[model samples]
Target: MEEILSQNEIDVLLSAITSGEMDAEELKKEEEEKKIRVYDFKRALRFSKDQIRSISRIHENYARMLTTFLSSQLRTYVHIGVESVDQVPYEEFIRSISSLTVLNIYSMSPLKGSMVIEINPNVAYALLDRILGGKGTSVTKTESLTEIEKILLNQIFEKATGTLKEAWSSLVDVSPVLEEFEENPQFIQMVAPNDTVVVVSMSAEIGEASGMINLCIPHTLLEPIIPKLSAHYWMDNTTDERDEEAFQKLSSNLQTTKVDVQAILGETRITINEFLKLGINDVVSLEQQIGDPLTLTINQEPKFYVQPGQLKKKIAVQILEEIEKGVNTHE
Candidate 1:
């Protein structure tokens, strides 16, 4: 009787344990079913050092070319300043640049009372005089110009901005905002307050009259727009494979040539009369004198200078020294 009772108790306990295990498994399945699923995807943009260098080069070239095209009498200097070089992530900024604002400073007082774009009074007068068709020398010694002078100055700024917008539209969306801060201390303070500034100074000489255009761009104003600038200016995807391949082939051909001749050596022009007058018996003088080492030209460029020599029956030239002329020039 005792053995029978013990067997029955063990069977009951085994059944209960199996039931608990099933219940726990079901609970786990239910919990898993209730759980929410999530998926994450991320994209990043990056700029290489070479890319940055290329972008800088492009901007520099654009500035120089624009100045040349404008035929500005004044020397123009374009300065770019980045305040937080490494603070922002490059990828996001490269994709979100939208618009650009350019501020031009015409003139400032000589006394350094505040930290703002400085322009000479004379420069402002000269600019106004030119636009007004008045003599630049006839500027009156006054703090303020006439109402018509102010209007003309404003027009000049508007025209300049419009021209720049047209020029830069293909590269980036640029909008010019011209502000004149002559005597308004508050306007000056509001615009430029310890901000990273880019100043482009353009000095022009219109006949005897000389003038300057000072462009000041504050860093704070430009900070939010940096990403836009990077996206618009830095991320260029217009490379042509055919053009690249052709360039590589040309480069290879150039590299294989033992000597490079340039046009500079043959750039010296001589009149037809000078050539026709020359006679085989007559001593025709050349720029190079006798005893002076003769320059060996390959591809019309002076590669080396050699004294005439003989190799058995054949005439030859012994290379005396490599031409010390500049890479861009012929011997």
Candidate 2:
């Protein structure tokens, strides 16, 4: 039964269908859901200055000195960036991150190009050489970088995780993982966005050679880790516990008062020739007398006159009288 409907009937049917459901409330709910932030697990690599400095110390005992060397060698400055669901622009992110008192971002590049950090060629070569324990001048040809050279650079950064763990202890467990972007689709996708990339560049001086170090981070790859890094810097629970324990142990110990004693009585001068010529039998005269109220010093201070005596089996001193006048004078 195939019956054709008239135009009026079709119109009426369409109108009825349209009027049957008014989803204004559902549309509003959908809009609100869209407004909610969707957290991505990939954005967990963003680290703070404290976290980076702590990590940097793992590479060298002198973190600040190393940083200065890096700056001088690289001829560039380090930068940090943060991105949220708000889609912060690259320049804005650089400005915000560089505003941190410690790191200084010299120049921020535009977000139009591929998410790659730009480092000075000379600095890169110097850094690579230094990391490899080779002379900075050893790197001659840029095209001569072998597969092993690339691997070494990667290893240097990867080893930084171990350094950070040792310094910070169990507060943070950060491991640098290198995934080949060419083969991994996820890696490429992670860096596809314009606002996702953060660049950290620094010029470092390694002896006579000056070089640079540049790091690139995708915004979505670091945002989640920011809180953890911040917590590691500000709320170090383990250190606080250790400090408290040390304080408790120190406070429980008994306290003792110490007495200080000192005295400058008198001085005498004699000729060197006379001293050398003196024989064991010869008598040497001193300004002090044998029994002219021998100075009785209590704690090295002249307090009373005392006479020497023998009491039972031991020699003793008897306080004749207290010297209440000016400094005791001797002939």
Candidate 3:
């Protein structure tokens, strides 16, 4: 039942309209222009656009590293690239992928909670086929992966974590340890249904088979380092002097790495017949003369000029000069 307008209200409305105090069309236009945005609390955005962009850049590097690693391991042309990075509800992420796909739940230590790496069934099977002595071809199988197949898949995920670590090293040093594997998404409850998760969707093409790889990183696990996931913070931390401890650690590790060094007397081009007819103690004339400095190469790159000599009754080469770039090593 509509209540009738009182005489005073009617008189004011009519007077306002007639006296040009209030325009009826203007009031209607104002009402029509007002907008109301519906906000869903379940899908609240926890990460800002800056943070999302930083995460996208980090995973872009991850795709390149994973592509190289997968190509070498699978012995096939594997192309992986970042398709989209978005923040969505945990339940939405879980429901977006296959029902019986491969879910690798892993822990990023020094940061609380666990994350997920969801692999599409087709891509997973193609990788499994390649590893199991078959061509890299995907098969549509409904049954869950067998025990042996799971073992092989686990190994692949474990090695892939190394690339993950390197990719995140620029933002945060994280050790991604695979905790468990699950076939059913509902069985795994690492994050709440309402919790926000940043999902890095990557398009992967291994040989002829193609699929997606979703990396669901929970907000809780990244809360501590959320500040680091900003363009400003990333730019500020780009200098080497900011991370002196890491630099020192890298220097110490490099000290222990062994590199091959060869002191070459000289180089000379010879025909296949000359190489084939060469015998032991054959005096193949070199391009260098006696008392001339030798080229000391490290890891196949000419780096130094040295003089051959005897030290403590053993053959040795004394460093004479450092080889500059574009210098002729034969001279």
Candidate 4:
């Protein structure tokens, strides 16, 4: 039930207002504080810092994966690292792209609308030239990409999108595909001007040259899965395994895993013609002393020095020394 103000209380309020005892600005501030948040319909709230941090962690792994994969594609030593993960307006995202660059709007299945991915022109040209057996130099001048350059970009894009999907597998299953290539980003209308989008900016370096790449994801698309992107989700995941029986089964299987090892005696070099002429009883001379220790190789790697012996009528190699090179799992 609501209580009505007494006449005396109403008189006191009127006296305070008339005597200039109550400031108008203070009253207005009090009213504003009482109201709920004032939301702007133009820009939607999507990601928090924690959520952004979680996404940044995922892209950090993506950068590592791409470093290896991109290195193979470019046939050089390339490194990729996440520079930032932040949310900005769609207009701002468009303004950040270069005038003439390799920026593609792509579709990620099971998510609404599309996303933007931009690669600096320097990186693109450097890769194109390197793939064709040229030095990967910094070419600042913007020239129309040739047909061969476009084919090369397509191959790189395909592999890059695959690596991105692999990176997102931890949070969610997504299939990212390049839908449109934009030479001029101003005319595109992927989202509303004031809409917010999450930007994942990454930096790549190959030898002396370096460049930036970006992924602009719409805020609305990520709003659906914001919970999964929370920092708590990532922090709790390591200790959240509840299936003890399943874990025990995995541990047991790993303990019982079997691996093959090879014991090598000696090596000899001979021509194909000489090798074919030799008979079964013929002895091949090796460049090794008769009592010298033999080498044992595992997984095509020399790991140990052993001596040939017969243990209970079975031919074997006794361990004489362990090599400290390569992956020394035996030690």
- Give candidate 2's error at residue 265 in angstroms: 25
**CA lDDT for candidate 1:** 0.46
Give one digit per residue, the lDDT tens place, for model 2 in 1-331: 9899999998886676689754656767998999998776434344555655433433333234445444454454422222112233454334432211111111112222233233344544665766655565424453534577557655544443333234333333443333331211222333334354545444454534554444454555544544544545455654664577777777776244344433223335789998889887897666666657566665666777767777998977777777776855543
How do the predictions measure up, each by TM-score?
0.36, 0.35, 0.68, 0.69
Badly placed stretches (over 4 Å) of model 1 are: 1-119, 134-140, 167-171, 177-186, 225-331
Backbone clashes, each candidate = 8, 27, 0, 0
CA-RMSD of model 2? 18.2
| Model 4, runs deviating above 4 Å | 1-45, 240-295, 300-308, 312-315, 320-331
TM-score of 2: 0.35
- The alpha-carbon deviation from the true structure for residue 56 of candidate 3, after best TM-score superposition, in angstroms, is 0.8
RMSD for each of the candidates: 17.9, 18.2, 8.7, 9.2
Model 2, CA-based lDDT: 0.47
Tell me how far candidate 3 lies from the true structure as C-alpha RMSD in angstroms: 8.7
> Model 1, range 220-325, lDDT digits (tens) per residue?
4444434545543544545424687889999999888785543221224468998788777875445655566667777776677677768999977777777766
Question: Against the correct fold, how does model 4 do in TM-score?
Answer: 0.69
Better of 1 and 3 by TM-score: 3
lDDT of 3: 0.91
lDDT of 1 at 40: 28
Lowest summed lDDT across 10 adjacent residues in model 1 is found at 94-103
Give the per-residue Cα lDDT of candidate 2 at 14: 67
lDDT of 3 by residue, 1-331 (tens): 9789999999999999999999999998887878656789998998999999999999999999999999999899899999999999989988898889999998988789998999999899999999987888999999999999999999999999999999989988889899999999989888788999999999999977999999999999989999898787887777536578888999999999999999998778899999999999998888888878988999999899999889999999999899999877555
* Best-first order by TM-score: 4, 3, 1, 2
